[model samples]
Target: MTTIDPGAELKARIAEIKERFAIESAGGKLTVRRDDGLYRHLEVEMPKSSAYWFEVMTWPGALAITGHTGSHIFRRDEDMLLFFRTCMGPGPDWKIDTRYWAEKVQPDGIGSTGVQSYAEDRVKAYIKQAAQEAEADHPGLLAEVEEELFSRYSKADLETEAGAKAALAAFEFDGFRFDTAGWEFTEYDYWFLYTCQALAWTVAQYDARVQVAA
Candidate 1:
């Protein structure tokens, strides 16, 4: 596989999206290496369709996630929530300062809380609606299927090498589509994540999201 420059990819994507989607406020930002990681930050405008996919895949629990192009603020205590921040930006212009915190709900629920709690009713409703549509459209449910298969194992087991092997053995999203509600568990979550990265890489090859100053 060839290497990619995330900054260029982000800008090109934004312009391309603006042209094709025809949404004025709909835009994106890219940030590279703010928190020290190999992957580039991508904060897309989160179109209705993509937002549905993001929620189904990430599955944030008991916290609120609010975001826009330059900012994506997620409130969750789970360890993965921290990683969510990095995932917010596309390449080099995303921010995580206090100004982005528009509201906080339900007080911190646990120790040294890392995420914000907002009402889940809206997102839940959207997710439910989206699931019905996906079922009809047959868009492929990799994340849900994978998470369910892996959920059976204890947290400790998931951390061990044996657990990883056992997990992958359970299911592979590419081969099938899982028809389930609420994502009980699956072995395909990690596989789905990596596969998504690979998909993004593939897209970048054909359509580099390059930034062009206005």
Candidate 2:
């Protein structure tokens, strides 16, 4: 029997997500880029269904209306778990609360693949609990959460093939940073723009030997 590599499979999964958003007919498709820190990011540019482009994108932070400018950021860092932990309080209005997941599943026997355990009943239980709690806090939050979580993420609709390639080429090489406590959407956008500007700072980190090898 042939052995399958889990790491390779994870990468493939990321690629699959990118492929899903590669359509061109509305604005553009999604793009994914790999970084040195084992971070791979997927960015999708949404289209306007309104006469006024700016008005089309206006939405309260984390609310589910049709077509909003947002990106689902995921990282392998254990620290990202804090966001999930915080969700158990007021709850993450927009996304799944993974901290409750750890609480329900108990991290001990989580399995080497990490993917397998995701299908377990405990994961579903955490999702249900989080959903119930969120719904209790604000009933609409559940519908919004479900829409973002389970809705068909059929790729952005671009006008032409060239436009699709342009969108892919536009993926900024920077990752994002945000403090849920302090930053609003505008602040988040500001930092995201600046982070794109600072992406090249990574190039300077290489030692002369490493630079030469590259």
Most accurate candidate by lDDT: 1
- On the 0 to 100 scale, the lDDT of residue 133 in model 2 is 54
How far out, in Å, is residue 100 in model 2? 22
Task: Please identify model 2 stretches exceeding 4 Å from their true place.
Answer: 24-214
- Evaluate model 2: give its TM-score: 0.19
lDDT of each residue in 1-214, candidate 2, tens digit only: 0132333543554345333322211353333332233222323333433321110111112111112322122233243323233443332122322233322321224332121222122222333344555455555655653443334662422233343334333322123111123211111122222221111111122222244668
Model 1, poorest ten-residue lDDT window?
Answer: 183-192
Can you give the lDDT of residue 61 in candidate 2?
A: 22
Report residue 50 deviation for candidate 1 (angstroms): 12
The 10-residue segment with the lowest total lDDT in model 2: 55-64
Clashing pairs in 2: 24-158, 25-157, 25-158, 26-157, 26-158, 27-157
What's the TM-score of each model vs. the native?
Answer: 0.17, 0.19
* lDDT for model 1: 0.33
lDDT of 1 by residue, 143-187 (tens): 463245334542323343345335435533434432323422222
Q: Tally clashes: model 2.
A: 6
Q: Which stretches of candidate 1 lie over 4 Å from their true place?
A: 1-40, 48-187, 190-207, 211-214
lDDT per prediction? 0.33, 0.29
Q: Candidate 2, 98: how far from true, in Å?
A: 17
